[model samples]
Target: MFVENLGIVLALTGAVLSALLAGIGSAIGVSRAGKAAAGVCTDQPEQFAKVLILQLLPGTQGIYGLLVAFIALSRIGLLGGGEIAALTISEGILYLLACLPMAFVGYFSAVAQGNTSVASMAIVVKQPTQAGKAMIFPAMVETYAILALLISILVVNAI
Candidate 1:
């Protein structure tokens, strides 16, 4: 029946959302950071390492999202299990809800982290020695993404 299949659909949607939203956010964040990195590198090519590190800072959210999605997919038997569990509607909804935190938080945090990275890159351009301080700003944004990841993981495991 259609109702029976709805659970699978919901599970799939959660997996997709977890990957898609976070991926998009990381892409945007990386792009923004890359631009700033390029601008800095244009003037001082030798500082590429610092700029690259800053540019990559926002990408952690995407990884966390992927981790959550992978775990969810495996839980739902979409990954590699020989048999898939028949999840009830409530279970499906639970799965979807579990993913929501990571999806939303990852998306927002990555973008914010990216902007912070860009600003940090600007600082690196002006005062190269201050790169350490600059990195701290964006690293702070990563805390929320980690928290979301933890929540999603725990929720999915519980379900």
Candidate 2:
């Protein structure tokens, strides 16, 4: 009984930690992007649409993390039956560890991407048609976030 309760605790901890990290990361990203957009708009008002889209790109990581957390919770039967199973210490640790990388990567990458997007918006101010090209750097930065999400998902599944 104690072991099962421990498993439930570990699983809930992992899910909550993962969600918090992702949320914080996305929050940082969105904040940076919004600031950049505001800065850009102050000068070139016409680039609002492009800048807004760019700002929104980094915000997706939080959503992905939330989804993964839901999956993890569902897998552990926390939402329905509330029944818990015993997990090996290693397995529980792995689940927690897996979420770390994604959280770290998502946070930094989003901030970097926000900076990149800001630069891109500056470029757009001069060459509106080149906005697409300017987005390449931010897109590249986003790849790591996707990778982190993949790793988190796989780890959760393994647990």
Estimate, for each residue in 38-57, the C-alpha lDDT of model 1 and write its tens digit: 99889899989999999999
lDDT of each: 0.92, 0.77
The top-ranked prediction according to TM-score is 1
Model 2 gets an lDDT of: 0.77
- Prediction 1 global C-alpha lDDT: 0.92
**Who wins the lDDT comparison?**
1
Root mean square deviation (Cα) for candidate 2: 2.1
Off by over 4 Å in 2: 1-4
Candidate 1 total steric clashes:
0
Tell me which residue pairs clash in candidate 1: none
